[model samples]
Structure formats: C-alpha cells, structure tokens
Target: MSGAATSPASAPALVLASTSPRRRELLARIGLVPARLAAPDIDETPLKGERPRDYVARLAEGKARAVSRASDEVVLAGDTTVAAGRRILEKPVDEADLRDMLALLSGRRHRVWSGICVIGRDDRVRVRIVDTIVAFKVLSAEEIDAYVACGEGMGKAGGYAIQGRAETFVRFLSGSHSNVVGLPLFETRALLTSVGVPLG
Candidate 1:
C-alpha cells in the first residue's frame, strides 16, 4: 500500500533573536511579525578596547548565531550601543550609574550605534550598522534626578530612552530616530527583505 502523502514544504520561518519588546514593537510598525521569538543568551561583554561600532556588530552577529533553528529558518538579531567619543556606555546598573551617564550626555553630542544581523535560510548572514548623532540639551541637576527617579533608564543603554520622557532632553538628532529606541526600522526592513522575508 502507498504511504500517506506528505504536506508541501512551507516557507522558512522568521525568528527574532531578542527579548526586547521594543524590537517587536518596531517590527510591528512595518507590518512584519516574526513567526517565532528566540532570545539568545550569549555573552554580550565588549572585547578589550572594542570600538562601539564593532562591539554592536559582534553582539548582533553572536545573537543571531546563538539561536537554534532549522537550516531553512531565518534569524534576526540587533544590538544598540551608546558611545561618547570612544567610550561605550552600557545599561545602568544602579541609580548612580544612571545619573552619571545622564550628566556625561548633558549638552553634548553622542553617537548611537545600532547593528542588525539577519541570517538567511542558506546560512548567509547580512549585517547593517546604523549610526545616529543625538545632541542633548543642558540638563539641570533637578532634571537628571527627576529622570532617574522615573526608573526608565535601568535597562536602557546610555541610561536613557529617547522615546520616553527623555525626548524633552534631545536638542537635535541626526539619523534614524528608531535606532535610538533600540532598533532601526528602515535598515531592519531592508535587511529582512534582502534575506527573503516577506513584508507588507
């Protein structure tokens, strides 16, 4: 007797290798929803004297590689870095750290680097790095304290979230605004599309 016929193969699934809700939100803005969410737990520590751009790129690639999936599936990952000159500002571990980061960014132009990595079904990896220049207004002591008290900077790079109350502090911004919020939608969309991910 002949065996039951198998179903036709389906398109490769799109996996988002991140735990950040902001990224999912950003993807929603472009009407693309990941078929699966795989949060990779790879070492995110910066290498010895790693530049901000390189640091983000490495982490994004690492995250995309860490997720386990079928060969036909696609994985997407991203990393955001806040840089003051050559210094990389990571997420704040405490209120003091948050305050310090705010002070350092006050009335200064800093760089926000976002790296996106997309691994295709054929294991071909594509990366895009986006850099944004953000200028902060001169912040008063009260302003810093108030912002810190809000507790929005706890897990945010550079101890701030531009999409939140921190928007008032930005005097000028030159580049993708979405990058500062954790993902670059335009770059991300282009990367996914290039890798055969369907979008509306």
Candidate 2:
C-alpha cells in the first residue's frame, strides 16, 4: 500500500515558501516547479542596527523554517534588501515612504541583497546570497513626481520595481539583474541543485 502511494523519480518538489508571484515566475524560468505555495507569516522587523546582509539572511532562513512545519515537503524561502550604506530599505507601505525611498536612491549607487534558503528532505539546509550593484541616472523632479503618482512603488521593496517603469532610472548595473527583481536565479538554481532539488 505504501509503495503504491509513493511517487518515484518524477514528482515535483515540495513547496515555495512565499506568496510572491515573482518568485514563482523565477522558479518556472529554471523549470523547477513546486507542488504548493506557503505564505509564512514571520516577523520581518530587523533587530537593533542590523546590517543589510545579516537582515536578509535571517529573514530568508526564518521564512524557510516557518514553512517547514507546515508540511513534510522541503521548503524554499527568500528575502531581498535594498541598502544604501548601513541602512536597509524595505517595502513601502505608503506614498511618503515611496517618495522618500526614491529620493534616497536617485542618482546614486546602491546595493541589492537577496538571500535564499532551502530546507531539504534530509533535514539539511542550503543557503545562498546574491549581491547586485546598480546606479540610477539622475531623476528630474517632474519624473519623480510622475513616478510617485503612478503608484507603482507602493508595496515594492526600496519603493521601486526595476521590472516596471523604474527601469528607466537604471544607468548601470553589475551582477545578477534578477537579484534586483527579487530572486537571483543563477544563485537560486545552484542552491536548489545543491539540495537535491533536480531541475531541468
């Protein structure tokens, strides 16, 4: 009976520990399909004076572990941080936040950090971090106002979405473009592969 119920050599992996459509889309790009999606509710607040790299890494791991208890299946989780110096920027919840984020990011170089974690069937954990540097072209006051009015930056990390109209602001980029989008596929694929999550 147990043998009849078990799928061998061909079943898709466990679950994506996020509700983000972008993450799902990125996974599909590498042909690593998931059986389910888990939106783990975890405290995203950074500790007192936490560095951007540590913050992202902790968030990803926390999310992965939160979902691990939901099912017997392996879980994949990720987090992204946009930082200028020691300051970590998060998703904007309102217009003011977006405006401030855009102003801070204007005509400057910033670092985007993406942390990925996968909990394997063998109870082992694999993690990876991707860092990308992007420089934005100087933005005019009219352009910034218009962009704020577009309302695209709301709920987006660092108050901007590179895949959207904000791409116009990018004058130079070094490292994985996908990292800025949310997930870095190259690093993600390597992490998944290392954890025995076969990808086509």
Best-fitting candidate, scored by lDDT? 1
Write model 2 residue lDDT over 17-108, tens digit each, in one string: 99998888888899977888889899999899999989999999999988844434678899998998889888888887888888899999
Judged by whole-model lDDT over C-alpha atoms, candidate 2 comes out at: 0.86
lDDT of each: 0.93, 0.86
* Predicted candidate 1 versus true structure: per-residue lDDT over 40-67, tens digit per residue: 9888888889999999999999999999
Pairs clashing in candidate 1?
none
Best by TM-score: 1
Off by over 4 Å in 1: 1-10
- TM-score of candidate 2 to 2 decimals: 0.91
lDDT of 2 at 92: 84
